[model samples]
Target: SQKIEQNSEALNIQEGKTATLTCNYTNYSPAYLQWYRQDPGRGPVFLLLIRENEKEKRKERLKVTFDTTLKQSLFHITASQPADSATYLCALATFIQAGTALIFGKGTTLSVSS
Candidate 1:
């Protein structure tokens, strides 16, 4: 069995600052880790995905780092704005494990205030 953990608590950051979120897993070595953003009253929106083999991946102001040895992944949002505020989730693709077993974290809410 695999266990994925996130802050479960909300993160507070000011606008224009860099918001860093963490995801830690144990009892499993997933080939890849994925990040998503969920706004109130809506489904999660995919943000980024990093493979165990990848050191870091970036797109625009979003960046993700996967450390297989540490069994952790870091998600960053640069120049974060108030609009960026949302609950971020880390998930593992169950399909990669066996057939299809999507595992998700409890999610960390980010509050970016201007």
Candidate 2:
């Protein structure tokens, strides 16, 4: 079955360290890729978006890459802080005649500690 997969386990890291998260998909061609951060009790917030034709995207301390050939995307947080801890989700969007369809991974929880 076509699916998007992210690490189900939580990633633990110390403050000031870099945290890397992986998102892999099978049997899907997405036009745009997006990363989002969700807090414990809040909706997910948009982080970065990369086009299938683009290799990477960055903003502040966040970086994301899309490799259609490899069917994967990597999300990174540089100099991560405790406040940066959250559940990160990868979303794939494909434009359809109806409009746009979005598929999201289960998300990988990140825990940054002091």
Candidate 3:
């Protein structure tokens, strides 16, 4: 069986520092991986997507690295601030009825203290 796990607790960090989070999984090789950010009571917004053939992907203050051998993904936010506080989700692509759906882990809440 395939499984994905993200940090179930919140991560608190001071403003202007880099925030790092982890996503671990087992038993499957996905076609791609995606990261999303969700604010309170809202749907997650897509951030980055990395294919299995890729090593890393980045956007603005965010960077993501995927390691298929270890079946893990690392997400980072540099120069973080209070406005950056949100829950980050990691999802892997799974095929369903000729379309793709993301298999998401429970998400890690990040609180950036100013």
lDDT of 1: 0.90
| Model 3: how far residue 10 lies from native, Å | 0.9
Score every model by TM-score.
0.93, 0.91, 0.91
After superposition, candidate 1 runs with Cα above 4 Å error: 94-98
Candidate 3 lDDT by residue in tens digits, 1-114: 468899566899999999999998886778789999999999999999998899999899999999999899999999999999999999997667878776898999999998
Instruction: Give the poorly placed runs of model 3, Cα more than 4 Å off.
Output: 95-100
lDDT of 2 at 63: 90
Candidate 2, residues 32-112: lDDT per residue as tens digits? 888999999999998888998899988999999899999999999999999999999999875567877887899999999
Q: Please, what is the whole-model Cα lDDT of each candidate in the order they appear?
A: 0.90, 0.89, 0.90
Which one wins by lDDT: 1 or 2?
1
Compared with the true structure, what per-residue lDDT tens digits does model 1 show for residues 11-95? Answer: 9999999999999998667888899999999999999888888899999999999998888899999999999999999998654
Candidate 3 Cα RMSD after full superposition onto the native fold (Å): 1.7
Q: After superposition, how far is residue 80 of candidate 2 from its true place, in Å?
A: 0.5
Q: Which candidate comes out best when scored by TM-score? A: 1
CA lDDT for candidate 3? 0.90
In model 2, the runs with Cα more than 4 Å from the true position are 94-99
Decoy 2 TM-score against native: 0.91
